[model samples]
Target: MHQQLPPEQLDRLICLEARIHKKSKEEIIQEQFLQIESEKQTDENDRNKQNMDSNKKSDDLKCSQNSENSPQKLFTSQNLSPVQKKSIITKKHSQQKKKKKTKEGQQKDITQYLQYQKKQQKAKKCEQKLMEYSIQDSPFKNKSPLPSDPALEKQLKEKQNQIAISEIKIKELETHNSELRETISSLTEQQLRIQDVVKQFAIENEKLKKQQLQVQLQTNRVRLGEYVVQREKTALVDVWIDGQELREAKEQSKRLEVLKAEYENKKKNSKNKEEQEMRTLNVKLNFLIKEEQQLQETVDRLETEKNLHIKQLKRVYEEEHARFTKNNDYPLIGERYQVLSLLGKGGFSEVYKAYDLQELREVACKIHQLNSNWSDHAKQNYIRHAIRENRVHKELNHPHIVKLYDSVEIDKSSFCTVLELCDGPDLAYYIKKYKCFPEKEAKLLVGQIISAIKYLNNHKNKIIHYDLKPQNILFHLNELKISDFGLCKVLEDDNSKLQLTSQGVGTYWYLPPECFHMGDQPPNISSKVDIWSIGVIFFEMLFGQKPFGQGVSQEKILKEQIIVKSQSVTFPQKPIISNECKEFIRGCLAYNQVDRLDVHQASNHPYFQKKLN
Candidate 1:
């Protein structure tokens, strides 16, 4: 709309957008058809029911009429119908089938429980008898014959002496029984405390069980509804097919008869009318074709003009990427340091290649959005970014990570991030230039991002790369560096802070499922959201186009596509670079987040595995 892009691209977009609109119209038509079919089905059912009622009424009337006109016939025991008996027997059979299984199961469980109880009783009785026998036999008898062997006798004597000493110690301990009882009481108190913890655990377990039960019940209800709808839809489809075939055949016969009659009865009049109509239609068709040719010429001229404008936009955008390409000549804006070019821009700030005369070195300066003085929330968030950027960079000294030079106080009035400039195109621009990047190149870039993510996550820093598109990845001297932490939230860092936000933050075409369903905004995205972004990148690398087309209203576009044709889930409209690549992309973009591979698993994927050096 702004004409920032070329006119031809815009025209193509307009045409493509029209096609999408047509698809949407078709979907509306389909919905209307479904509604009509439902109404038809309802009407048919009502008509059939009415017909049956009418037929029953007629039969009743006929029976009454016959009974009145003639003498009433006597009924006998033979009045019982065979159909009624068979139906009764069938019901009885079903009842017996169900009841017999239940009865057998109940009887088995009863017998098992009774046997278990009897075994417990027997054990108690045996234990009681054994204890009584031991009590009665104790002091008055030698329970066995004395050993005759000299060594055995000596061992026995020693054992008896040890036992006596043990008995004396036991008696002494009994004399100090109050102290022992106090110790036992302390232990018992500890045991009670442990039991209390166990009881708390049990209560928590019960609560979890209830929650699980509710979830399971809801799942069952949904599944049941889905199955019923599917079954009904299948039945209707079959009926529609049969009715369509029958109607076509009948209509063909009727048309043939009509045509035969018309040809025989009104041949001369019909011929004159047809000749007149053909002459009129030919004139109209000639006029329409002439108008269409003129419109096509106008469209072609516009296409050329639009392409020129797009080329201009691409040049401007590439100039920004080129600024990052000139790592040595970073120039800042507004002071003695003229901002040579815009390096990159994000939701928060624009990065510039700035020159510091005093330092006499090129530094990548991030111009703060606060210079314009936005809202308090904006300031706080930028402050958080500055802090996180500093802290994380200071702690993490990975070679893959872009190095932070300093957070300089410019003119004692503003803050600018001075970073070590890297001379390479970002992955987004790289892929755009190359169309679909080779597997080796893609994985090499991905591995670097993985290294950076792992470093962040491993530091117990919960700074998920909330925006992990290819554009954010800079390719510097064969090393990929991740940039832009504007959307990052510090979750499990030393701060121990929690945030719940649902604002659309990342690029829409590359959004995850959570971002899609989390409403009109991005959700309080998890690390899993990064995983989804990775999936998008994975697809982008394998295909020139994104899984969802590059469109402003792509969210809505994809939503429609998913609604009408879920099975058409695919990569770019262009042919695939590889099947393995497609599978890899698909695995990452699984609708169920749990089904997707984690970063580690993804890195080792067969498609990527070969590319890993």
Candidate 2:
């Protein structure tokens, strides 16, 4: 493989390495840039030709050879001596193979041609037979034409005239024949002398025939030049699409990095500006305090003099605070997130219109920070969660996990978790808006989601998602990512022993039966708990309902149904679902943890219909 690279590609690679050493990562890919550019030009030419195919102006050249003995003409114009043909072609738009004779069609045509020739031969044979029969039947039949006309008198006159003309013509012909015979005799003598010359010409002819045969042996195979050219063009097109994509990706990456740098600088400037303003205001306040203190020492002498100024300043401060609080609707806003509005709310957490404030763009920011309303327990929980979120996200490198820009612990108990806001609605909201997804698409979504979970499951310090349900999961474009890691617990690295609790913390509906029934049970299970939650989410994605939800009474709903009877989950009858998909849902819905589909096997389950890939 190393030896196979063309010289140009190897050169590009050398240049690329040099550029890398210079610390500029943005350069044409060493391995493919040369190939891509070369192929790009070829593909463009092919595409132009393909577009003209409608006008029927294609390269008229076609494959024309059959038997090894029959050598056809080769275009010496191109000097295409190689066995294989090359052309500027991409995509599968190869020239249509001329529909050659199928065995049946060939046989039919051959039979027809033979029959037509036989009819002509048979007619000639019949004529010869009649001629032979006529001669045997009547000897005078070939003698002369009958004098059948009103020309008996004219016949005598015509005979006399014909006699005279015959005599004159006969004498002339005899004289000419005598002279021709002498010339023939002389020519015959000359021909004897030229026998060697005739023999030499024959030898040259034979040589030419042999040369033709040799050429056929080498190039006799049918060469579909036009077809091949089209195929090359098609292949080149695929390569070009791939190359253009690569180029665009490189550009996008460069732009993203630039934007991130700009954003970081802007944030720094904003902070500095804020700090300067605060410091200046603090200095003024200190000056006022000092002046007040100086006046207070002489207050008894001039108490009434300071009263009006103090009252006016107190009113001004109250108005300013009120105006600031009312206008700032975001906790994570740096310089972005003026629009798109607030979407939803949380109990301890508030979803805001805060910008992503990372790179060149903005996304929703899920800012979790300490506030006056949170209790001491909540505050302690937020602190651990903030630390955990930062640690977990900082380590992860996946598409599904929300990106973390910057994490900051403000004051003693407050912290903010900056995140990338997704474009799509939550799975629950999507289900409500659009009742059911197209079957294959739904399977694809679940497959990606499960795959992300599978990644986390295998990752070091496995993420134990204490909370796993549809609400916490966001359907961001293609991926169904598990979000809100506030309740998530990362297991110890070397001793990754999980501690599960009967003290149900996550979404109750999605909680596994084992967690629900752990009253006297020892420690719960590992991250397998999250697997069950994912199972619940999968079931809901398909069936559009939690496993157990029928009764009006809370106890009847929780205990009287789901755990014992997992069969209550039903699907809408009119919908079309393959048997494979139904089986996956059933497996996921199993009550016993041991009877469940583990992340490893579930991803490749046939119920996916191999549609996920």
Candidate 3:
């Protein structure tokens, strides 16, 4: 029989043999059919040959048996050894068994060959059907199925039913799994919500506990105050009683002295009568002496009580003052600063006199509060203005420029800028008090201002103090210090001639004509604007009033075009300002920006350069 391929090789041939050998499945199936038939034919032939051989062997064995059974053979067998005779008999039996075994094996082989032929026929028909289906519907199909036999179809149907049931079970399991996941997610969310609630409760509890503590403290303080008041009242009553007792004791002592004098006089007149009177007077004097001793002791005790009361009151006052300072007198800022008093208040900011904790010096804390009511844009502009102020002020280290110590944003709504504290009054207050300044003193002060301005303009980023005014200028130890850079402008570079976006941003009286210029396009502001402001300030110092727009509202100044139309500045007759100073002021207050003196020119002017006579 031909060697059969293993199941793996047969499956490979069925699936991939066509692709490898470039033969169709029909050709491969036909070859396999021919091969199976040849194997069957060979097997049948081999079985028939074995049967024929068995028949021949049987015939030979029958002859031998017949010969052995003959009488002559019998006499020979009897004469031979019993062992030989037994071996002969056993060989005959072995031959018969071999014949029977051959017959049985041949029958088995025939049956197996028939079964294999039947299987091959069925397989051939199935393969033919699969090839037909593949050609008809799916030529390139990898897994074309064979025609269904009844038994195989039944099994397949059962298997499909079982698979469907298993799929249903899998779907149910998936649904259950999804439900479990949803439940787990819900539980986790609940846990998170509970945690958040617990945190809120904890915070509220802490707040309530703090509030309870505060209430208890207030109650205790009230009780302590009542006790102190009662003590003070008792002390006052005791003082009054002591004073009354002291007066009564003094009267008694005076009476005793008067009686003694009377007794002496009587002794001079009548000796016996005077002796009786002297005894009475001596007894009265002894009683008065004891009463005086008791009164002195009471007085000493009263004095001690008075001293204790005074000390207690002083301590109480000190504690109240300390508590007030701790609670209300100071800003909410930590230990960094202690606000002493409000130095000044402006439209958008407040200045407080504060003691710096780290620097151990008094500072002016300018606080800007961004009101919630303000528009978002306004708040942003306010913050940007403060930032610009900090940027410009921090770079300056001039003696006349107010030193910036620290700048901090307290919160979203508050900003603080700490600056050098000027102990003396502002220039406005000084001008108001003196009505005007002497040309000599004004020269000294104005020169300092000009020098600071010169330094500012000469900086890499030219700075213009747009809002220079008497109120913004401060005196620290009688030295002029310029302050309040909120409305100041910074140029890109020294040669930058950038137009001013904020057209009107200074005190109307101090603003130059260019600042008041109204047109389609804003004017380009330079150091000349500051020079005009300096002239205005100098004119005010000498004449005690603004040259162009004194006591004029900004609205009126804009509406009337006061600064824009002014041809020249006029001086007061009573002030009698010198011509040199007047000429300097005129140069500063020139209507045209080009005609206005620059800070350097103004600084080197003969008025400032001249030595005091």
Q: Which runs in model 2 stand beyond 4 Å of their true positions? A: 1-327, 330-340, 356-358, 371-378, 410-413, 493-497, 550-574
lDDT tens per residue, model 3, 137-247:
666555655676999978987998799899999999999999999999999789767654554454455457546755754453332321232256447332222234344
Candidate 3: 10-residue stretch with minimal lDDT: 221-230
- The TM-score-based order of candidates, best leading, equals 3, 2, 1
- Top TM-score model: 3
lDDT of 2 at 403: 65
Residues 349-405, candidate 1: write the lDDT tens digits: 667765554455555777664544677787786677677766666555678777776
Q: Provide the RMSD of all predictions against the true structure, rounded to 1 decimal.
A: 49.8, 45.5, 24.4
Evaluate model 1: give its TM-score.
Answer: 0.42
Alpha-carbon error at 357 in model 3, in Å?
A: 1.6
lDDT, candidates in the order shown = 0.59, 0.56, 0.72
Measured against the true structure, the TM-scores of the candidates, in listed sequence, are: 0.42, 0.43, 0.47
